[model samples]
Target: MISSVYIHIPFCEKICAYCDFCKMFYNEKIVDKYLDELENEVNSLYRGELIKTIYIGGGTPSSLNIKQLERLFEITDKFKRNNFCEFTIECNFSNTTEEKLKLFKEKGINRLSFGLETTSNMQLDFLEREENLENTKETIRLAKKLGFDNINVDLMYALPGEEISDLNKDLEFINSLDIEHVSCYSLIIEEHTKLGINNIENIDSDLDYKMYQTICGFMKDNGFNHYEISNYSKEGYESRHNLVYWNNEEYYGFGLGASAYINNRRVSNTRSISHYLKGSYLLEEEILEKDDLVYYEIMLNLRKSSGIDLEKLYLLYKVRLEYNELVNKGLLVLDNNNLYIPEDKWYISNEIIIRLLEGIVYE
Candidate 1:
């Protein structure tokens, strides 16, 4: 039952220095053409599956004007998600308005994800995100007023030259909001981003790790579940939409630069906006061998707090092992039928996950 969907919005008001996502600075004429192409692309992708979760992620979905946004939503009309458990739309502080929030609500969007990034004006400016703090506060207020209770606020930690005091300030501000979900990510200076070119050379690894630990402690103390590596939620507010990805389940990813895994094949769409608009859709496709599937499944599942399900692994891969080896090695532990990497090892989960997979493959 493929019940999840992800839509990519490739337009942005202004590209942030740290962003490496597919995005282009706001251009009115170009966006109009993109919207038209987006509709066609979506129509071609939906194969009458009743989606249970729909996510509109982006460079910034809120970057669209009312007309362009409407065209995008119109394409979504083909989807029959009457059983949809969650429909989330990602927005930014600068573009989210009461009217926009209402439009989302009307279109069955129940969750609003705000790219709050950080609470500090200094950090916001440093990222070239000149959105007014008051505006962000109001955006959340409007979302809540429109009956949106499933709100997720995104924050970042360990930016260039950040301090413990800065992280504390961010935590303090987040706790004050009526947010039920938080996705806090450590700053990764990816190669193509402006931050990578100009500022990444000066990052302090120890300080960054410390900030990550602080965020985990603060969010846990404030009644949030460290559900996934970079996501925390209050009980039932965890992102059902994203779990599809971490579980390695198949779903459709439409729009430029999006990737999808379906029917045991992984496919990626063309990244060039012009090429996409000109009808060059998918760029690559790779069919997963049994071993490849196992590797991918293990890699994604380890990111969750519940870790991997041993029974599910055995059921899918016909694999088994003596659990004692990993537990004795202090890499994994079994609790209530689920396997988990202890929180302490979370910082080095990649090494541990690879080791666990090696054990699975060998046994």
Candidate 2:
């Protein structure tokens, strides 16, 4: 039951300094051609499955003009979803408008995710991001007017030279908005990004941990569930599409630089726009062995608050882990056969997950 779908739109109005996603400048001709190819790809591969969730991630899906966005939605018409579908599109503060929001509502887009990585004007300028605070407020107002309640915003902290006061202001501003979901991520200076090339360094580890703790406390006080590592949500407002990945469920990923797990294989699409335009679609394919898949299942499930079902793990891998070994170390909690990392220990979950997996030995 491949019930989730992701479509990539690799065009952005202006590139952000921190972004490392596969993206290029928005061009009318290129967008038209890409939509045509995107439609063809959907038509060719989709098995007409009823999708439960659809996430249109980007370079910036909102960068496209009305007609271009219409064509993009037209491509998605081939697939069907049920009444509980969570259809989301990523938008930028600069490009979102009343018309765009209305168009999204008309197309049955129930969720809107905005990239407001930080609210501080200084941080925004340093990231080369220009935001109109009044306009952003208006955008949220319009989205709510259009009956969108499943709204999400991304906030980045642990910035170089950023103060705790700066992060508190961001938290206060987001709490003011009636948005239901939030994703808080620590700054990672990845190679190939402008910040990386400029020799920028990350904040001190202790400072980053402090920021993370602050965010967790704030969200908890604000009646939000710290559902996943970087995600917080109001009750029943969790991101279903994102959980598709963390739950180790299969789904389709389309467009250049997209990756998919299906037919027992991990597949990635070509990252080069020229190559994709020239019909060079695939970049790599790895057929998963049973043990490889089982390991993936464990790693991904442990990322969620619900944790891994130990019985299911045993049934799948035939490995019986000594539960007390991890529980005694204050690393894992066994509740109703679901093994999970405690909230305090989620920061170092990678090391604990590695230790737990050591109990498994494939035949």
Give the alpha carbon lDDT tens digit for every residue of 260-281 in model 2.
9898899999999998887778
Q: Given candidate 1, what's the lDDT at residue 186? A: 84
Superposed by TM-score, candidate 1 places the C-alpha of residue 71 at a distance from the truth, in angstroms, of 1.1
1-363 in candidate 1: lDDT tens per residue? 577778888888777888888888778888888878877887777788888888889888898999888887887777887845588889988878788888998988898888888877888888887477888777888788889999999998887778899889988888888699999988788877888787465468788788889988999899999989899999999999899999889888888898888889999999898899997888999999988888888889989998888788878888764567879888888886688888877888988877777676434
Off by over 4 Å in 1: 321-323
What's model 2's overall lDDT? Answer: 0.89
Error of 2 at 154 (Å): 0.5
For all candidates, what are the clash counts?
0, 0
TM-score of each: 0.96, 0.98
Let me know the TM-score candidate 2 reaches against the reference structure. Answer: 0.98
